[model samples]
Target: MEAKVILIIVTTGLIWLIQLSSVEATQWHSKQLLPYFRRIKLDKTKNSVYQHTVKDAIRMHLRIPLMQKALCLPKGTKVSKHLQYADVSFALIILKSHCFHCVLQLSSDCLNRMVDKARQHENKFYARFTYACKTHAEYSSDCMESGRPMYYRNLRNLVKQTEKCWKL
Candidate 1:
């Protein structure tokens, strides 16, 4: 009986080892086949062109004018007055959430490029604008009472810190 039990245990162990080896072999075969099934790599020039195309598409889609409308502010309206509107706060919150998601979809390289473009246009306001919208969206009443300019400057500084932390 003792001998029989030992034989049974040995048989089970061998079976497990065989199954493990078969799984490893299958994985090795799949690894060998991967390159054939994968997408072909683009040259650096082509890749950069594609990246720029995508970034421009995102920028066009996420233009600040669209966000301004969402915040219920007309194109020529003063930001201070618009900030006081009850709907402005709600819109800003929604815009901030949407921008957070949109930005996440973009690569850090793309964001850096966008920042560079904004700088070249003397539009340092882009980052500050987004930050202010998000901050006021969060604390609408308090932000209005305390002052929009102060919050905007503070948020802009925060945006600068965040940009500094991003990988180049």
Candidate 2:
């Protein structure tokens, strides 16, 4: 009788533990996953302005490398030398090969050009937004007097957009 009683108690304890774990897991999913998926959906719909800005910035950015190549500086020459001279060359080689597999990787020339273009785009976007904010703040009264609140609304939107861009 005592053996049967202990067996029942053990089974009940195990069931209770399993139920508690499942409840915790559900709570975690609701707290973490819901916001992540919602943000992704929001990001997709609202990215048009950023997309156009990035595209223009990238286009202008790509020209610099073409100009450099035209000027006769061979690509990868400086980077290869720098990598070879660095003390972490072996570790870097292993990491590069492991992560990128080398086969589908961009050539050093192309990678550098793309990185530069991205940097330029980021700078340009920041500058454009900053200038807009400054200009609007200086002439806010003009905007208010123009018989349309469009400029103030635009300025508010610009501030919000700038915040989003900076987060990027």
Task: Tell me, by TM-score, which candidate is best.
Answer: 1
Clashes of each: 0, 0
Pairs of residues clashing in candidate 1: none
Q: Per-residue alpha-carbon lDDT of model 2 for 51-134, expressed as tens digits?
A: 454443333333222222222223432322211113133333333222221112113343343344334434444444444444
Pairs of colliding residues, candidate 2: none
What would you estimate as the lDDT of candidate 2? Answer: 0.35
**Alpha-carbon runs more than 4 Å astray in model 1:** 37-39, 47-168
TM-score of each: 0.26, 0.23
